[model samples]
Target: MTDSVFTRIVRREIPAAIVFEDEQVIAFMDAGQVNPGHVLVATKRQVETVMELAEAEAAHLFAVATRVAKVVQATFQPEGMTLLQTNKPAGWQTVPHVHVHVLPRYANDGAELVWPRKDPPLAELQALAARIVL
Candidate 1:
């Protein structure tokens, strides 16, 4: 894959207000801040989606996101918090990188995650669960 904007940030080709970094991950302030403490935690390897990550990579990705959320929570003191991870374009993934948004939310915040409910019957749900059960 060609280098993503995130890859450029990781390589210092672009500037970012990075909050934390280690060998595998980086946490930085999002340019489009929906809230004051909005942040993005992403993998250093530049994988396009979460499904592509190895088990340990995925684990560390979220671990760092959790740590970033804690700091953002204390610093911003928002009414609520949201950890958003998207997949493909259909899943609202604007950036093609494995990252999670740590957003500090307030009352009446416009950020919305709405999905229609099917409310399938128990038998149908049970059948579906059986098909994908690990």
Candidate 2:
């Protein structure tokens, strides 16, 4: 597979305002600023989506996101925060590589996160749950 833009950034071939990094993950300032400190946390081992992650890699990615959210809260001091992760194209994932977004949010920031409420029938919900549940 071709190396992603993120992989280039990881290799330091391109420059980015990186926030935090470890052997397993790297948290860098997003190219576009949602707030003062919108960060994208990505794994060094590239994959297209969260489903491709091993259980431990997913856990570590979110763990890093959780920690970064706290730091963003402390540094930016926004009223609230958001942790957004997108999947395939339909899910609004612009990049092919997997990453998580941490944005510091304030009231009336003009960013909207909404999904239409789909009230599925009880039988439908039960069937979906049965398929997913271990």
TM-score of each: 0.98, 0.95
Error of 1 at 25 (Å): 0.4
Model 2's alpha-carbon lDDT is: 0.93
Q: How well is each residue in 22-126 modelled by candidate 1, as lDDT tens digits?
A: 999999999999999899999999888999999999999999999999999999899999999999999999999999999999989999989999999999999
Superposition error at 115 for model 1 (Å):
0.9
Clash count list over all predictions? 0, 0
Candidate 2 TM-score to native: 0.95
**TM-score of candidate 1 relative to the true fold:** 0.98
lDDT of 2 by residue, 55-96 (tens): 999999999999999999999899999999999999999988
Which stretch of 10 consecutive residues in model 1 shows the poorest summed lDDT? 125-134
